[model samples]
Target: MKYSLQDLIDMEHFQQKLIAVISKSGLKRLTEIEHRKQIEKSENRYRSILKASLDGYWLTDTKGKLLEVNDAYCRMSGYSEKELLSMYISDFEIIETPELVAQHMKKVALKGSDRFESKHRRKDGTVFDVEVSLQFRPEEGGQCVCFLRDITDRKSLQDRLESLWSLAQMTEAGPKVLFNLVLEKTQELTGSRYSFFGFINDAEDQLEVNAWSKEAMNQCRVQDQPIHFPIAKAGLWSQAVLERKPLFWNDYNLDHSRKKGLPDGHVPIKNFLSVPILRNEKVIALAAVANKDSDYTSQDVSQVQAFVSNILLLIEKRIADEALQKSDERLKLALDSVSDAVWDWRVHTGEVYFSSRWYTMLGYEAYQLPQNFETWRSLLHPDDLPESEATVFRHLKYAEPFEIEYRMRTKENQWRWILARGKAVERNDQGKAVRMLGTHMDITERKQSEMAQYPCQHPSNWYFNKYQR
Candidate 1:
């Protein structure tokens, strides 16, 4: 039953009802304060999770304007939280233009999410590659949430793989240019201001320059100098070569006795590193770098040594290739000097390489003859093949040098006496011939002259007797 307002006002207990109504109001206010406290506690938990994330993250409106940024995002951008929160998402990208970012966001909304690698510009004006995952939330008025992971280290590995491939391609460039490239790349890779590379000469006493980088030359401001840099003249460069290992001087001034000081116009070196290029325990070349920004450490020494060790195979191969080329030239000159022919047979492959002089001796071009045993069999006299084969088999079996006089059919179809001398230069574990090297010389005139002087009734018999195999 409801009491009328006049009835309540006239009752004596109306003041007690007023107190109860005020008490109910105070209880409702207390409940609301507890609810607000719970909400604040949950918000704090959410913020802590975001702040502790390893990946950088931020929230943006559909218009790409940044609404909220996490601590990670601030740290990643090299910016403070207040500064990043004031900027737009588009402002962080170094590669993506404003128009491009707009297009990306449009596509991302259609796909619900998108992930890609792009460069991000830091506040310090440096850039690094980042993997960005963008998510669009239709529930929040098309807001975009993004997570970023830095991939600069991953990119560096890819770059190193490319560098190895480039080094492989350097093989065809010849050892001289290849060495130059190696030195230049080493200086750049090691962050050195100057590079020095010297190769030991034939005398084995002098260190001559095989390659010098243009950058080192430019940095040192030298004119047609730093050439040779003899082993006796240079201090650390020579010392490294003598030690047959890598050496580093963190401070050249502290050890004045070891340092001869830089020559006029040479680069003023700071921390120094040097390594000897070894082949068969012999120091054949020297490589050094100097003038680093900071003091050299044991890690620097190890890094340089590892780098040199990595490319040692290529360096040795290049040196061998150069030596082989020079050897071929000298062999050619020697053969030409004596007007002799040369042939080498690789037994394993059953293939033969004939020198130009060998082909010219038979009045045939080098390319005209197929590089196989059949070429020799076909050009040799039928009677001479059996004897030559028997002689070769016996020599290979006995490990003896085969020196025999045989008749070879020339291009003109005339029989010419040739003195063939050959030996198995390389062998396998079983003592079987893997390779054979030899030379052939025309002895028809000498035999004929001996026969003429003997003046026997049978000219062939006289020639054989006078020549005496």
Candidate 2:
């Protein structure tokens, strides 16, 4: 059997042998044939891989004019294959300019590759985010190949994550302010005219709006006040709360059989989404967005889920902090209303907060006394320092009740008897004293009275008699 030249060339066997044939021919014609075959094989391989990619791919020149495009790119750009071939990369880059491209090319030249995020315009003029990874193909006339992935959803998720991080860092913000921040960030995310995050009233029948977007307040609230309603209503958010799941509606006006209608002064809505903020498998709060220019989607619900988690965390922290602060205030008030001087010391840091009574008891104005451990130590008579320090160390180490008598120097530079009484008020995880609260009472008059009643037995009587001389 004989084989024709074309048949032999078409066979896979002949193609494999072409590698050897080209090298042996060493002539320009055979070399060109080999080169053409190699180019065809490369193109086939490129098309098979790049066209099948989920991301778009584009090959362009240094001037940005498109040299080639994969099927995905043509679909993404909303352009036909022929039309895209005639366009420049700039035509689709909504946020990038010639100068930016030039700068990007410079980096690509130095690094041989670069990746960045930018917005791209489709043929119909809508814009979305894209992450482009560009590689320089130096072999081909300053050509560059780009791998493009649509990152609109990823960018939105990242923005929500960043908002969460910012809110987490703002632990000092008041609860009201933090709630408003949640609404604002969510409003921007959903592109809604109104956003609401609120909890159910104790009755479980009323949903109280804790936070509302400014637009929601103006349009839906009563006189710029929060707007909430009975859970009995069949509104989108109410249904979400009752069902304990997310609900989305694109056209509420079209529904006639729904159990609820728009409330008085409520903003008219084209579309809305509502999701439950559940804790321990129970609905604790509801997050809702309404009157978005576009329709509400399931994607919007998922996005708000992330926001809701962060919001709940911040709210829980704020509530705990507020309770602690109130408790602190009550304790301080109880200590302050007394006639005795008070001092609360943070044992770990050596910081002291002295009450105003402490200054007045020593015959000085409130501002005259310094709030420091060293200041307290300086006011102690040198004779009292050793016993006072020893008592404090024993009390801190053993949780022993601290009650001792010491001579404290007054503002007049006179030694006065004081009953120093205190106990460790707080402790660290290792059972070490971290805070201590105590009181100082001026006992000079009592000591003098005792000395008069029993002059022989009182230790200070001889000193008193010597001073009298």
lDDT agreement with native, every candidate: 0.76, 0.81
Alpha-carbon runs more than 4 Å astray in model 1: 1-55, 62-83, 90-92, 97-99, 110-112, 121-127, 179-316, 355-357, 365-368, 381-407, 414-419, 441-469
Per-prediction TM-score to the true structure, in the order listed: 0.61, 0.76
> lDDT score of model 2?
0.81
Backbone clash numbers for all candidates listed: 0, 0
Best by TM-score: 2
lDDT of 1 by residue, 176-288 (tens): 66666667666755567777677776555678776766766777765667466666666766787766677878777776555677677876767778877676777776778
* Model 2 lDDT at residue 74: 77
Residue pairs in collision within model 2: none
Q: TM-score of model 2 relative to the true fold?
A: 0.76
Candidate 2 on 384-461: residue-level lDDT in tens? Answer: 799899999999999877999987767866667889999998988999999999999988889889888888887656
| Best candidate according to lDDT | 2
Candidate 1 local distance difference test against the native: 0.76
